[model samples]
Target: MFAPMDSTEIFWVATICVLLAVELATLGLTTIWFVGGALIALAAYECGAGMPLQLILFTCV
Candidate 1:
């Protein structure tokens, strides 16, 4: 049996993708910073950080 990714992981990844897409489409710096934060949170999620920790890192980044 293959298990799917958790909801949190899915959301974070989706957020990262969407942010990158929007940033690229606009070629703007606004969302780039957010993309950095989202990437950090996504990495943290992959490293097994909890939601609260992810949110904190996202905000700090």
Candidate 2:
């Protein structure tokens, strides 16, 4: 089994998945940016970033 993920990790992962799905479905290159942001945010979270920092990374990445 996989290690348990915290809510923050789950949220970022879910966001990435949903955005990826939307990008795949549309192929319009819209949600792709958000997907990158989500990925960065997830990385930041894994690096022990705080919620505010994670949100900032998600928005400004």
Candidate 3:
């Protein structure tokens, strides 16, 4: 069985995946920043940051 993951974690992971797919399909590199942002948000979530903090990290990173 897969390891249990929080819904927020799944959301960030899915965001990263979709952004990556879009970046690959277009190769325009625009979504790369979003991928980085999602990664930061994921890390923040793993560190138990609140949604507001996670969002700030996502936007600032």
Candidate 4:
């Protein structure tokens, strides 16, 4: 599990950044969809989602 880096906003942002980087690198819309998912988790995290729920929200986008 990830430790120390406990802030969900940071995690979501980092994930979106990486996703965007991947999208930009390959210009693949696949990563763009995942970026959307990360945004959803960001919103849910703002609403106080737990890690499990946040992960699920990320997966569902």
Over the stretch 1-61, how does candidate 3's per-residue lDDT look in tens digits?
9879978999999999999999999999899999999999999898889999999988887
After superposition, the stretches of candidate 4 with alpha carbons farther than 4 Å from their true spots are: 1-6
Predict model 1's lDDT versus the native. 0.90
Name the best candidate (by lDDT).
3
The C-alpha lDDT values of all candidates are 0.90, 0.92, 0.94, 0.85
Native-vs-model 2 lDDT? 0.92
Please write out the lDDT profile of model 1 over residues 1-61, one tens digit for every residue. Answer: 9679889888988998999899989996889888899889989988999899999999898
**For candidate 1, which ten residues in a row score worst on lDDT?**
2-11
Name the better of 3 and 4 by TM-score.
3
Looking at model 2, report the run of 10 residues with the lowest lDDT sum: 52-61
How many clashing residue pairs, candidate 2?
Answer: 0
- Mind sharing the TM-score for model 1? 0.83
**What's the lDDT for residue 52 in model 1?**
95
Error of 4 at 13 (Å): 0.4
Q: Model 3, which residues run further than 4 Å from truth?
A: 1-3
Q: How big is the RMSD of model 4?
A: 5.2
What C-alpha lDDT, on a 0 to 100 scale, does residue 19 get in candidate 4? 91
